[model samples]
Target: VNTHGNTDFRNLFSQLIQKPEEDLELDRAALYLAGEEYPEVDVLSHLAQLDAFAAQVSQRVTHETAPANLARAIADYLFGELGFDGNSGRYYSPENSFLNRVLETRTGIPITLSLLFLEVARRLGVRCSGVGLPGHFIVGLDDTGEYLDPFNAGAPLSMEDCRALVDRMSAGSLEWTDQFLEPYTKRDILFRILNNLKAVYMQGREYTKAVGVIQRMSIISPGLPSLYQEQAWCHAEQQEFRLAIGTLEAYLQEAGTPDDSKEVKDQIKGLWSTLSRLN
Candidate 1:
C-alpha cells in the first residue's frame, strides 16, 4: 500500500483496539452512522459490510458440514479465496450505485450487507466489529487482536484512508478526530438508517415523510435537538403553526446557542405570532 493507504490502516487498527468488548451490538453503529447521538449504545463501529457478509454465511450454512466448519470456511473464503488486490480499486455492483441501491431497496441493501458480514464473522469466531465512520459504513475485525478493515474487499487500510474518508464527507468545517473511529452497537445502526432516510426525504422535497422519519428518530435518539427542529420545520411548511412553535421551543432549549440560533429563534417567534393570529 502507498503512504495514504498505510495511514488509513493504522487509524482503523487504533479504533478497533480502543473499543470495549461489550458494545458489539450492531444497532449502535447504525444510529451513529445516521448522524444521531444515542448515548445508550456507546460503541462506534460501522455496519457497511453486512449485506455481503450475510450472503456468504447463508450460502455456507446451506452447504457446509457444520457451523464450526462453516466458520473456518468463511475465514478461508475471505482471506484465501478472495485475496486482496490493491489494483482492484473499489467495487460497486454494476446494477446499483450506493445511493441508488439503498434508495431503491429501502430496507435491505445497506443494512443487509452489514448484517451479513457480522453473521459470518460471528460464525467464524472472529473478533470482528463494525465501524460506522462518517459518510461511509465499514467493518473491522481482530487479526492478532488488532482491528482490520474488511470492507476494502478484505484488504488492509492505513489511518490515512480513514482520515481521508472523514475529510471527504464532512461539511469542510468539522475536523476529523480519532474519537470518530470507535466501535458502536446495533441500536445505533437503526438510528443511522432512519437518519439516512430523513436526508433522502429532505433532499427529494418530501418534507412530510422527512418529518415522520425524524419523529421515529426522536424515539431512537430522544435527546437530539436537531430532530425536533426538523420536525418543527415540517410542521411550519404544513401550516401547523402551533405544533411548529412547540417543536422549535423544545429545540432551542436543548441546542443552545449556535451561529444559526438567532435565525431559528426568530423563526420560532414568527411562528408563535402566526399561531396567535390563528387562535
Candidate 2:
C-alpha cells in the first residue's frame, strides 16, 4: 500500500471505532477495509460509483413509488445488468471477501454480494438490513421484511423459502429458527465478513493476512480481547514471536480479568518459552 492508502486504512478504522454504534457507515467502512488490499484503489471513487448507480437506478424507477418496485429494479440492475453474483466455483477464495475485487470481477460470496446490494439499495433511498443466516448471508427490506438473496441473482425469497434453503444447505439436518432471519447490524456484518476473510487466510497459511483481518476486527470492536488474542496466535503462526508476545500482553492488559489474566499469563509464558527456543 502507498502512504495515502496506509493513512486511509488507519483513518478508516479510527473513524469506524469512534462513531456511535448506531450511526456507523458500515458499507463505506467495509469498502475502505477492502481497499487496503488494493493500494491503487480510490475508495471514495467507488462510493461515488455507488451513488452514480443509484442515480441511474432512480432514472429507471422514476415512475414507480413502491419499495418492492425499487427492490426489483435494484435486483435487476445489480444482478442482471451489472452481473454481480456469487462466486460458487471458488467458494472459499479470499478475493471474494474484498469489495474492490468483488466490484471489479462482479462476483463474491453471499455476504459480500449482499453488502453491495444493501449499499446500493441504501444509496437509492430504499431501506435495507443484513440477514445473518446460518451459513449464508442475505439482505432484507426494512418496512416489508422481504428478503433478497444476492447470491442467487438477487432473488426474492419468502421466510419459508429461506427456511427451505437452509434445510437444503444443511442436508435437512439443521433446524430452522427465526433468529437466523434477525437483522444484523453494521458491526455484526463487518465482524462476520472479517471472520470469513480470517478463515480464508488461515486456511491458506497466510498468517500475516490473517493478522491483518484481525486488526480490522479489533478496529471494529476495540474492547474485544479475543480478537487481540487471535492476532497473537496469527503472529505466532507466522513465526513472529515478539509480535505474538506483545499482542498477547496487550490482550491481557486491556481485556483480561483476574482469573482470565492468570490464564493469559500461562499462555504468555508458553509464548515466551517458544520465543526463547526460536532465538
Candidate 3:
C-alpha cells in the first residue's frame, strides 16, 4: 500500500468538511480522504464515473416512473450488469474503505458499496440515505422507505430481515431496534468510514496512518475526549511518549472530571516515567 504523506490532501479534506453538512459532497470528500493513502487519486474522474453510471440508469427509467422500478433499474445496472459487489474475503483491507479504489476494483465492504449505491442513487434523482446497522451498512430509499443491501448485490431488505441481520452480525449480543435503520447524515457516513480506516490501521499497528485517521475523525467531530485518548494511544504505540503525554494532558484539560479521568491521569504518569527513563 502506498501511504504517501501529503499535507495538501489533508488540508483539502479539512476544507471539504468546512462546508455545511447538507452541502458537503460525500464522494469528493471520500476521494480526498483516500488521497491520504493514495495521493494520486483523481476526484473528478471518479465523480464522472458516477455520473456515467447514473446516465446509464436514467436511460432505463423516467422521472415519473415508480420508485420501486427505478430502484430495480439501479440495482440491475450497478450490481447485475456492472458486477459491483462486497469484498467479503478481505473485508478489513483499507482499500475497501477508499471510494477511488472501490470504483476501480468494483468490490468493497458494506459502507463503500453502500456509498457508491447512495451516490449513484442521488445522481439519478433518488433520495437515498445510509442505514447504519450495528455491524453492517446498507442504503435506504428515502422516497419509498425501502432498504437495499448494497453489499449483497443490492438486495431489497424487509424490516424483519434487518432485525435478523443485526442479530446475526452481532451474534445476538445487540438488541434489535428501529433506530438502527435511521438514515445517517453525510457527516455521519464520513466519520464512520474514517473510523473503519482507523480500526484497520490500529489493528495492523500502522500507528502513523492510525494517527492521521484519528486526527481527521477529531476534525469531523471535534472535542471528543475518546478521539484524544485514541490519538494518545497511537502515539504511545509508536514510542513517542512525550507526544502521547501531551495528548493525554490536552484530553484532561478538555474533559475534566469524567469517569475515566483517574485512569487517564495514571496513564499520563506512566508515560512520563517511561520518558524520564529514556531521557
Candidate 4:
C-alpha cells in the first residue's frame, strides 16, 4: 500500500468516526473498510447502486406505508427479487465480509446481509437497526419491534425464535438475555465488521491484513489497549520484531500496568534479545 494512500484513508476514516452518531454514514464507512482489501473499489458507484435500490422500493410504497408492510416489502425486494441470500457454503470467505462483494454476489454472512438490509431501510425512512446477537446477526425494525433474518431469505423472527437461534448457535452454552436483542449503533456495527475481518485474516495467516484491520479498529476505539496487543501479535507473526516491541510499549502506555504487565515485559525482553542476535 502507498504511504500517501494510507495516510489519506486514515484521515478520512478518522473523520467519519468523529461524526455524531446520527450523522455517521454506515454505508460509506463500510465501503471504506472494503477498500482495505480491494483498493480499487469505487465507493461512490456502489453507494449509487444502493440509491437505485431505494428508488425502486420507493415506487412500491407511499409515505403512509406501515412499518411492518414496509419491512416485508424490503425483504421481498431484496431477497425475492434480488436473490440475495447467505453464503452458507463458504461463510468464512473474506468476500462475505465486504459490502461491495455482498452487493455484487448477492451472498454474504449475517452481518453483511443485515447491513445491506439496514442501508436500504435507512434510505426509505425506516427506523431499522442491526441486532448483534451472539454468533448471529439480524436487522431489527425499530418501529414494530420485529427482527428480520436477512441470511435466511429475510425471514421475520419472533422474540422466541431469536432466543432459540442463540441456543442453537451456541449449543445452549450462552444463556438468553434481553440485551442480546438490543440494536447496535453504527459504530458498533463497524467494529463488529472489523472484528470479523480480523479473525478471517488471522485464520488465513494473512498477518499483514490482520494488522491493517487492527489499525482500523484503533481508529474506532482509540483508547482500546487490547488492540495494541493484538496488533503486536500480528507484527510478531510477520517477524517485524521492532514494530511488535513498539506496539507492546504503546500497549503498556495505554494500559498502565494491566494484569498481564509482567508477562508483556518478559515478552518485550525476549523480542529485544532476538533483535540483538539478528544484528
Q: Evaluate model 1: give its lDDT.
A: 0.53
Supply the TM-score for candidate 1: 0.54
Candidate 3 C-alpha lDDT tens digits along 1-279: 122246888888889899997789999999989998998888898999999999999998877888778888999999999999999899999999999999999999999999998888888778889989999999888878789899999999988889999999999999888999888998899999999999999999998889889888877998798888888888898898888998888788877777889999999999999999989
Q: Write down the RMSD of candidate 2 (Cα, Å).
A: 2.7
Consecutive 10-residue window with the lowest summed lDDT within model 4: 1-10
lDDT of 3: 0.89
Model 3 TM-score relative to the real fold: 0.95
lDDT value for candidate 2? Answer: 0.83
Scored against the true structure, residue 189 in model 4 reaches a CA lDDT of 97
Please report, in order, the local distance difference test score of every candidate based on alpha carbons: 0.53, 0.83, 0.89, 0.89
Let me know the TM-score candidate 2 reaches against the reference structure.
Answer: 0.91
At residue 257, what lDDT does model 1 achieve?
70
lDDT of 2 by residue, 98-203 (tens): 8878888999999999988888888878889999888889899998888989999999999998998899888888988898898998888988999998999888
Q: Each candidate: how many clashes?
A: 59, 0, 0, 0
lDDT of 2 at 275: 80
Q: Mind giving the per-residue lDDT tens digits that candidate 1 earns over 76-145? A: 5654565422222323222111222322332233333444455557644555556677876655554432
State residue 156's C-alpha deviation in candidate 2, in Å.
1.2
| Candidate 4 local lDDT, 1-279, one digit each (tens) | 212125556667778999999999999999888886777889999999999998998899988999989989989999999999999999999999889999999999999999999999999998998999999999999999989999999999999999999999999999999999988999999999999989998999988878888888888888586787888888888789999999888888878788889999999999999889989
